[model samples]
Target: MNEEQLFKQISLVRQATLKQLESVTEAQADEQPEGFRNTIRWNIGHIYVVQNSLLAKFGGKPVATPSRYIELFAPGTKPADWEGDIPSLDELKQELEEQPLKLKEVLSGQLDDEAAQPFLSLPTVGEILNFTIYHEGVHTGTVKALKDKAAK
Candidate 1:
């Protein structure tokens, strides 16, 4: 997809993800629904860190995160096993709100620049941006499904 379309997708998904996350209380965020993968809280932090890391692969550093969170919530981890420094629900929400704008600024300025490098071996800048949107969709869907289950 073109950078403009890609950015629109990111903006849409990030906003929806934030709305879903905001619906849950901090207490609800503490526990994963049975047979579910992650608490909404974990997904929030994971989304933030993964996008940040992806940008870093292209030599654009994301805001620093505590090492403990990296160990606890990185991909392939399950919620039950997480034992890292969990940020407050509010902090996670704010990062979710802020990251897309940061991403947009970075991408808007560099999409055509020869200086922009591949992130994590992604063949194109488009691929890296797409992955970020896809990642948000995954967790946003996860959180929505879990919330539905909790409601029922």
Candidate 2:
């Protein structure tokens, strides 16, 4: 689809995910739930980092991930021994809200073109955006489940 549409989809997914996270405590985000695992906070940051990398590759403006998260989240670069503070859930959600508008501005009239190229397992940015839609949904479910577990 077009850039506007892509932005809309991203915004929708992020908003819904943020809604699920509303009123969530730090404890809930750190808890692991059955079937739906992973701290909500981690997954949220994970998705944000993915998007940042995707966009950075598309335009190469953001440089690389900070040394810390790079090892933890980079492709084929799982954390060996990471031990540091990560961005809080609120910070991540704020970035989710702010970064897209900047990306949309830079990507105006370029979404289809940029996303049309081959990248990763998917060919084209469009494919990645589509994948992101479902990716967020799956994680959203997991986060919701985690919240359920934390409530117990």
**Model 2 weakest 10-residue run by lDDT:** 73-82
Q: How far does residue 51 in candidate 1 sit from its true spot (Å)?
A: 1.3
lDDT, residue 21, candidate 1: 75
Q: Model 1 — TM-score against the truth? A: 0.80
Backbone clash count for every predicted candidate, in the order shown: 0, 1
**Candidate 2 lDDT, 26-99, residue by residue in tens:** 76666656554356766776766776676567433342455555545554432233367766767777876776
Write the residue-wise lDDT of candidate 1 on 1-152 in tens digits. 67778788888888889888767888888777668767887887888877766666564444355566666567877667756456889987887788777777756755544324665567555577677788878888888887888788
**Over 4 Å off in model 1, which ranges?**
58-68, 112-121
Candidate 1: pairs in clash: none
- Per-model lDDT: 0.73, 0.65
Off by over 4 Å in 2: 34-37, 58-67, 74-81, 114-117
